[model samples]
Every structure is written in structure tokens, then in C-alpha cells.
Target chain A: MDNMEDNIKCVTCTAPVNIAVIKYWGKRDEELVLPVNSSVSVTLDQAQLRAKTTVMASPSFPNDRMWLNGKEQSMDSKRIQNLLNEIKQWRKEKHNGDTCTDGLLMWKVHICSENNFPTAAGLASSAAGYACLAYSLAKLYNVEGDLSAIARRGSGSACRSMYGGFVEWDMGSQEDGSDSVSRQIASENHWPELRVLLLVVSDQQKSMGSTEGMQATLKTSQLMDRRIQCVPESVEKIKEAILKKDFKTFAEITMKDSNQFHAVCLDSCPPIFYLTDVSKQIIQLVHAFNSSCGITKVAYTFDAGPNACLYLLEEDVGRVLSLICHFFPPDKDDLNTFVQGLQTPSISPLKVLLWT
Target chain B: MDNMEDNIKCVTCTAPVNIAVIKYWGKRDEELVLPVNSSVSVTLDQAQLRAKTTVMASPSFPNDRMWLNGKEQSMDSKRIQNLLNEIKQWRKEKHNGDTCTDGLLMWKVHICSENNFPTAAGLASSAAGYACLAYSLAKLYNVEGDLSAIARRGSGSACRSMYGGFVEWDMGSQEDGSDSVSRQIASENHWPELRVLLLVVSDQQKSMGSTEGMQATLKTSQLMDRRIQCVPESVEKIKEAILKKDFKTFAEITMKDSNQFHAVCLDSCPPIFYLTDVSKQIIQLVHAFNSSCGITKVAYTFDAGPNACLYLLEEDVGRVLSLICHFFPPDKDDLNTFVQGLQTPSISPLKVLLWT
Candidate 1:
């Protein structure tokens, strides 16, 4: 009653993470899912997506019970089941020398994930989720490997999630993907003045998932090869720019890379359009505003989603925020809510005001 | 005829033609206006633009009279006046060598041009109009030197109009542009079955002129170098494809080149958006229709404007026409008016329908 009943209770693990400045686009191997080029990312403070997971081994449970974000999902999917089975097998192999099981090992795993903001708001939730899942599971089961290596199996971008601050995923040449792992460049504390504003333009789910869309692009796009080859140089330059705190170079590279990524999406054989009219309008307005102000004060980046994440220097935060508010003026009733939400406590003491 | 009466009289010349498959985008030198790459084009049977010229050399005529299209344009503009003065000087030199000036330098030129379509339709009207004007004036006054060389002075692309069939503009490396000239690739009779459908999306003038836009892009765009360097290979491949009558390769190259050109436009520092929503929609619809049909039947190309030119194999012309008709159905009242204009003797037995 003691051991058997105690095993029925669930245990949980959780991890929080950030976004990549340099994007990861194509995969070298689909099975191992090694990327074709190295990528660099920055982990944000006071803004993150967390993934909480609980894994339990029970003698009485007939099958695995899994829940994601309070909703029960089918463990009937072979992929999830396979991963769970592998974790159990690793645990058993670690403690017991012989493989003799009277019944299938039963475990209940629950994941209650939440983001400070919206899920599909271009904040790289999947990157954080898969990275957290792989890291937490490996720790819980005592998996014999580096956390980054294990995370790579979950998602190519997940490898970069194992580290806390600036991380790089070096795309290795090994067939087994043993060399492909995330390496830390700088910690989050290194760049305290840097602030990112997640501008939620539209909360609609993306029309195309990154995985399927990227795979389609790789298969059919003539521009894919050129983009993959061209982006590495951009990544290298961005790394240097960040190290030197050259905001001008950093902003230029980030914008160019984003544009090039979207260009590849458009140049795909069937064409995948991730940018809406609103997104295009935002880009135009941002450039116009920058030129009008005679300063490169703010920089914007977008992922697979239509939302924009603007990065501003500490000195220019107030002005850029004001511009943003003026451009996206709130409705009469929502003016206060909008202004309160837009204020950046990290950079400015003065609060942002939104006119109805 | 008396010199006084001749001065009062006006002689006008008008010649209109159409553009072919080959496109000319960049120039090596602004002064000589040499192209950076060779291009091939086809001359259309149904000319849509014309150049009208009236020459009067009598003492009574003051200055150069030039009404471009319907408006009385400034011949005093340095560019226009310089060209006219050069032609006059060349005629005077020719007259000095001849005893009778009547056979040679009898006229000063006044030119008025109009397009049956719109000027900003991306139909290469300027190329044809300028070329025709140069050629007609040269013939009228018995000017010396090759007509191609003289036409090149009017407009870089105008040199190609000297021939009525398939023309290739050889982008020579010479500083003086002595070697840069348009050569005939194939006679009009070579591919008589080939046909092009011009779909006029918008007749509004482009925000940026082609020459200005190209210069801006060359100086500001990071992608410009890549485009200029990469396109030569594509151009070579397209030439081979066209020569071999390889529609698949030709279509692929054409689409890629057009996309790259547009990409370069977007990559410009200020960003030039020549494509409208309708243009993008047409591209997407055409691709979807072709892919769904499981055949590559029709290809579309865009110049500096939002208008599209659909190129189809002669065999698939009827099907493509029907598909276009289905998408843009003709109104009953307008259908009669359209058909009345289609009564030209050269009109094919194929029904003519306008796509709005």
C-alpha cells in the first residue's frame, strides 16, 4: 500500500524561455532533425513562455494519462507514446539490469503551459514548449545525454532553449547529429538595457504551421537554397553586432533577415504568404516613421505570425512607444487598458498614454 | 515649295509596336546607357503605341516644337533639347558633305507621341515610341550611321525596335557603347504561333519611373548585386530554353527572373512596391490553377507596372483564354463594343475577349 499508492501520485517539471534573433529555417535531416546552419537567439527577462510537466509511474494505471494546458489529449498518437516509452525504458535500464516487466510501465504526464502573452502571437511558444519538455523529461528520468542534445530531438529550435541567455545552435556535419547542440554566447544579465515590445497586431492562428510550411518550402522553393546559404553570413554579422552593441548594424541585419525569410516564403513553389495587409502597412509605417524622425530608433521583427516585436534602445523607448501608441490609437473605452499595457517599466518611468 | 510656306507646314510621323519576351532592366552606364546584361524580346503584331513626328527647318519656325502625347512638353528640358541639337548637328555635318542640302538636311524635328493603351501600363511603349521616332527622323533627313546606333541614343531599349521580330540587346562592356547594340534573334516568321495576352490591371503612372527606380535600387539595395550577378546565368539559361523551345525551362526562368526583379525592388532602401493586390492575386491564382490542373500551361510576367502579360503555347491559348474569361466575365453591353474594335484583318479566327 505504501509504495504502490505513492507511485500513483503525479510529479511535475517546468522551464521558461526566449526568442531567436537569428532564425532557424531548414532541416538537414528530418529524422534526427539537424539544422543546415547555425542560429543565435536572445533570452528575454520579465517576458517568457513556461511549460510545466508532471510525470508519474503507477502500478494500477492501465495506460498513460497525458494533459496539455488543462486539456486531455490523446496519448494514442504513436509519437508521444514512443517518447514516453523511451523515457520509461531509460529509467528501467538505469536502475534494473534485467528487462523483466510483468505489465507495461504506466505513467501519467500533465503539462500546464502558459505564456505572459498570447500563444500564437509570434513569441516562439513551440520553441519554449518543446525545449522545456525535453529538458524536464531528461532531468526527471536521468537521461544520459546533454540537455541540448535531447532537446534537439524534440525540435530543431529547442536545442537553443537549453541555455538561459544568448544561445547558438551550431549545425554540425555528423550524420548522427551528436555534434549539433546549443552553446551559450552571453547571459540575459549581459544586456540589461535591451527591451523588446511584443505588439499584438492580430491573435488569429497562423494559416501555415512552421514545420509543414518550411518542409514545403525546402522541397519546392528555388529560393530556399539561396536563403539558407545567404543567412549564415547574416547570422555571423548579427552576432558581432550584438557583441559590439552596434544597434544600427543589428537593426539592419535583423530587418534584412526577416525580409529575406519572408521572401523565401513567397518564392516557394506554391507560395506561402505570412504577411497580411496590416503587416505590410506596419512595415511601411515603421520605415516612414524612422525616416521622418531622422533616427534609427526602433527595429521590428516578425516570425511566422503577423504580430510585430519591436526592439528599441533605452534612450529612444519613450519616443518609439509614443509613435506606436499614436499609430495604433485605442478605442474610447479601451484607451486606459491600451496605455497601461504599452508602458515599458523596464525602460521608462513615464507611462504611455493612448488617445481614444 | 517656298521656305516660308514649308516653315508653316507640319510633317508628322507615327509608328507604334509591341514588346517581346526579353526584358531589359539594368544599365552599365547612364551616359552611354549601355545595358549590363543581354536580353531577348519579341515584337508584337498588334502595336499599341505610336510616335508622331513633324519636321520643319524653315527660318520662320522658332525653337523646336514637341508635343509628347497630347501635352505640349518642354523641349527646353536639357535631355530632350540636347538630343535634338545632336541630331541637327549631325544633319548639318552630312549636308556639308553633300552639294544639295535638299536631299539631306531639309528639316528640324517636332515630335508628338500617343499610346493606344496607357503610358504606365508596363507595355514598353516608350521603347517602341522613342525607337520609331529616332528611326523615322533619321530616314526623313537621310542621316548617317547605323539606325540601331542612332536609336540607342533615344532610349537604351529602343535599339531593339530596329527589327520586327525576336531581338536581343547585347550588353557590351565598352565605355562608349560602340559595341552595345540590338541584334535579331529570330525573324517574326520564326515563331508565328506564339501569342501574348496583355492584362491591364491599372493604367495609373508608377510612383517611381523605371530609370529612377533602377538607380535607387542599385545604390540602396543589398540584394541588387546578387540580382545583377545571378540574372546573367538565368538569362543564359532562358536563351537556351527559348532556342530549344523548352517551354518548361523557359517558363521557370521567366518567373524566377521576374520574382527576383521584384525582390530587388523591395530590397531597395526605401522599398518600391510596383505590384498591386490584383497583381499578386493573379500570380497566386495562375499558380494554383496550373498546379491543380497538373500541367504548366500558362506563364505570366510583369514589367515595371502592375499589369500582367500572359504567355501561353499556341495550343493552350484557347483554354487559357477561356479560363481568363471565366475569371473576368465580359459584360453584355461592353462585349459588343469590344468586338467591334476586334475587326482588324489580321485578327485571328480565335474570339477576342477583354479581361478587366
Candidate 2:
């Protein structure tokens, strides 16, 4: 709500990160970030990894200002410009000038965003960052219609973070990308027993960004054609597995898709290597651990970076966690350091909320 | 030739190792070593990396005896038995006892094989080893017709080594493997300027043997099906490249095929990791070097080991070799010790030979 004295309207929203089970790799349309195949992801608990974004609109401000994690950044970037344009178009179409004053829609805005976790920790911060920005700004402007589509214009994977549950982004066939949007497949409450562990393999920035890597893959990878053809079947199977809470099938498919993604990277001309030696060792260790138990108790998947995100049932999480600690003891200096804000203190304040 | 007083007949032969440009990763029939797809290779110089074999047949010996690199090994292995049986059947069918003594044909045989380079250097010794054994025995028994076919029974890639210069192993469609044979694509002297440099990255034995690796790939790799379907096209293109003496296309196809083979390994369920960190570094360095040269002056390929075999024109070989020595300076201990047999002294005697 605006403070009438200053003519300042402000809104704050937090969005959690979403980890893809069926990965989104090559893009059909690079400009709109339209994926070659549909993808599904599990939205993580916002208490553990969330981006808190605040948007303030004021007619007195001369220009739009943005800050990310206390560092001021340019708002003239293409992605930011695209998101701002789409939201403004939506506001004009929905409100019909009924509740808006003249020049109010053209007011300059300030955006301040921060993340609880390390930005370079290989976590999907952009997904949460863009999602939070889109949601908070939409609330401040009274914009209507699909917010996920608005977020998709900013970052493709960010569209999935708009919902707290299992989400799927359909790689729509429309040329304008009007039909390409993310929707929640099921609520987070559907699989209450499922637990995800973030194995922070590194805190360094990736050598190849996802955008650059995907473009090279599309241009050079011979296997990309075959992978796109087979991914639709994988998406359907993973979605069904999530609905039924089938950990074994889900784990197998997740691991396979991760490996296939890396394989495609290797198949690229001059090749792109995202996984480090540690990432590879983690892969072997997970398989060995699962084999030791005589069943699939844990599954590991890696994104464009080396960090591994593992999925398991609540009953087996403790055992696997203990195994990880035993093998990879934490550094002595980091024993008392609170890196990730003490690990999601309680579940009470962790609910995913939609900004109104 | 036989000396009646000594009651012994002796034959000596040498075969060169073949470096696959298009690899053979899976088998349709494990027992017969029938490949799922055809493979093309360049048979290297025997003088540089060869397997030498000596076969002796004597009425005085009590039983079959074999020695590998001066150490005695068992002759009861399945592969050894298959090679012996195939040659015996060929001998009986072709010669028809016209010039053979009935008792001499049943004499006991002894085989001794040796290699100058490190057997554990990942140089595809088995290809040369079996090819030499098959050729030597065929000479000893006065057998005729398709010695490469007989070598195929010993080791699949060994069949390709039976020929000089460029070679291809046809993955026959017959269930009985009756038509599966290696054919010479070109003579060894076809491209005299072509040089292959063996960068022995490591002398360690591979953790997984090719037979075991291929079996795992066939059982688990999801991409293996697509790879097999597309390899016939690759085989044709590579053959064309070699015939046309188009070094750029040959290099591109070689590098691509190597990456695809490793990709299939990664796609395998439970996955097989054959390339080490050093191998990956070599790949990057090769690309960087080619980019710097503004052309594909050198190309590198790896088998199921970390060692890299690079193909370049004789003119560029010195530049690449100097580049390698500069980048990967040898340790003090290895300075005096000539590993991989002092790195191909000269191209004078280094010519692929066809066994007749």
C-alpha cells in the first residue's frame, strides 16, 4: 500500500528455488528461453533457500534502480527490461484505467533483492531471484493474468519457482511463446515424506553459464537431437512417479537424465565440462551407497554446476546424511560458522505464499 | 618349413596396432565378439608399436604351450581355443591333405609373443597381439583365406589390425557371424605423411576391460541404441575422409567419435568412467592448439584408457610434439627411462605391414 505523504508503494515477496528432475537443456527459441522439451522440478523449502525481494514504486524517483545482495546493478540488462515491459503491458490490459491515476503506471521503481544462501554455491538463485521480483512487482502494480509467464520472460527456470509444489513447464509449440508457461502439477503436501539434501560441492562461479552452455549445445551437440526426441517420455514417467510417490522409479529417471545432460555437454564440439572430479566421485559414492543398502535409498542430480542435489525418503535421510558426514568431514574452520542461516529453523514460517 | 631331424616347424610374424577413428563400444553377440555397429581404424606402424609372435609345431612336444612377453600363460583360454579351432578348420578345408602328412597335422604347437612398449600403456595391444598370433599360426598350419576373420575370433579389434593403413570391421548381419570380417580400406603407403603420436598419459591398467565395458554399455546405456543406428553413417564419412586425404574432416570425425564413445559410457546405468582428469585436459589442450593454428592441424583420440593417440601430418608433428613436451614436462625419474619405446625414433621403418 502507498503512503500518501510520499506517494511510495512498496511490496516484498520471497520465493524458493526449484530443482529440476527432468532437466531443461537445449532451447527451441533462445530469445524467449523456450525449451526443446518439457521439464519438471521440485520446489525446495523456502526456509532453506529463498530470495527475498522488495519493490518500491514512487513518481519522485527519476529512474528504475536495482540492487542484488546489497550490490547495485544496472537495470538496463535485456532480461530485466523484458520483465519490466511485460508486467507494464499486463497492468494496462487488466486495470482498464479504473483505479490508476495519470502517470502512475510510468512511475520509477526501486528493486532490492537478497538471498539467504551463497550466491556462488551452485544453487538456482536466478530462478528464485526473478520469481520473487516478478511476484512482488505484480503485487505492487495490481497486475493480473499469468505471472509465471511474466517470470519466464526473465528466466525460463524461474517460472517453476512461482509455485510451491511439483511444477512442469510445457515446451509449447506456439511461435510467440504465449502457450509456454509453468503450472503446478501437485502441491508440496503431496509428498510430505520426500526429503532433499543439498551437497554444496563448491562455492565458485561456474566456468560456463547456462545460457552460453545451452547455445553451444544447440549449435554443436549431435546427440541433442536424439535427447529432445526421448525427453517427452521421461517427463511423463517422472510426473507419474511424483504423483504415486515412487522413489525408485523417480530416482532412476532423475539420475539418468542428469547423466544424459552431461553426456550432451561432452558431445558438444570442443565440449563443455560442468562436472568436476568431485562431482564424479559423488556420483560413484551415491551409487555405491544405494547398492550397499540393496535398494535405491538415495538419488543424486547435478545442474549446470558441480553441486549435487540428492533426493531420498525421510526414513533414509538420516542414514545417508551420516554416510556423507563420515566420508566428507566438514572443515575445522567451518565447524562453528553459520553459513546458511542455521538450516531452516522450523517448518511453521516456511509456507509458500502468493503475493496479492 | 620343417626339419625332419628336429621334428619342428616354425613361423614368425608381426602385426601393428590399430587406433580406431570410429570406435566399437558394444557387441551384438558377446561370445562371438560381433559388434553392434561397424568400426573404422588406422593400423599403426609395427616398427613403432607392434606385437611379435613366434609359432612352433613339433611332434616332439607333449602339449600346447604359450608364453606372453617371456612369461608363460595358459593356452586353455576360450579366445585361444577359438583361434586355434578356426585356423585348423580352414587348414583342412583349403589344403585337403594334398601336401600335408596326416600325423604332422595333429602335432603339438607352442606360441611365444612379445611387445616392445608397455603392455599396460593402453595402446590396444590385444589388437596387435591377436592379429600377430593369428597370422603366425595361419603361416605355421599352412591355412588359407580370411585371416582377419580368424583374428576376430581372438579379439574383435584385432581383426582390423590384420590389415595395413585404413581398415574397417564389418559388423555382419548374420547371427552366426559368418560374414563378419575386416577389410583394408587403403594401403599403408596411401598417406605417408600421416603420423600418429602416442602420448602415454598413464601406464596404469584400465580398471574395466573393453569386454566388460562393452557388456555394461550394451546392458545399460540408453543412448547406445541411437549411437548404433547412426554409426553406419559415421563409418562412411570417415572412410571417405581417409580416402580423400581430407585431414580436417578426418580430424573432426575422429574427435567426435571419441567423445561419443565416452558419452555412451557416461550414459550407461551405474556409468563407466574411463577418462581421467588428465585425459580431459589433453582434450582441451588439443582444441586450444587447433584453434591457435587456425585449422585442425592435429586431432586426438582415446580408447578405453587415459592415453591419447594424436594424428597429424608429418610437418606439424614436430610442432605438436614440442608443444606437448613443453606443456607436460616429464618427471626427473622418467627422463632417462624411455617409456613407450623412446617415442617413434623415425618414420623410416614405421610402416603398417599386411600379413600374407
Model 2 TM-score on a 0 to 1 scale: 0.91
Name the lDDT of candidate 1. 0.64
Q: What fraction of the true interface does each of the listed models get right, in terms of native contacts kept?
A: 0.09, 0.49
Residue A31 of model 2, lDDT score: 76
Q: What is the TM-score of chain A alone in each candidate?
A: 0.84, 0.92
- Relative to the true interface, what fraction of contacts does candidate 2 keep? 0.49
lDDT at residue B169 of model 1 (Cα atoms): 78
The alpha-carbon lDDT assigned to residue B201 of candidate 2 equals 74
iRMSD per prediction, in order: 2.7, 1.1
TM-score of every model versus the real structure: 0.82, 0.91
Measured by TM-score, the strongest candidate is 2
**What's the true lDDT of residue B20 in model 1?**
40
Tens-digit per-residue lDDT, A177-266, candidate 1? 879988888776666667666666676887788878888778865556766777778878888888787877877777766776676666
Per-model CA lDDT versus the true structure:
0.64, 0.83
Task: List runs of model 1 lying over 4 Å from the truth.
Answer: A1-5, A8-17, A46-116, A120-124, A200-208, A212-229, A321-356, B1-5, B8-23, B47-58, B76-108, B120-124, B144-149, B220-226, B240-246, B314-356
RMSD of each: 5.6, 5.0
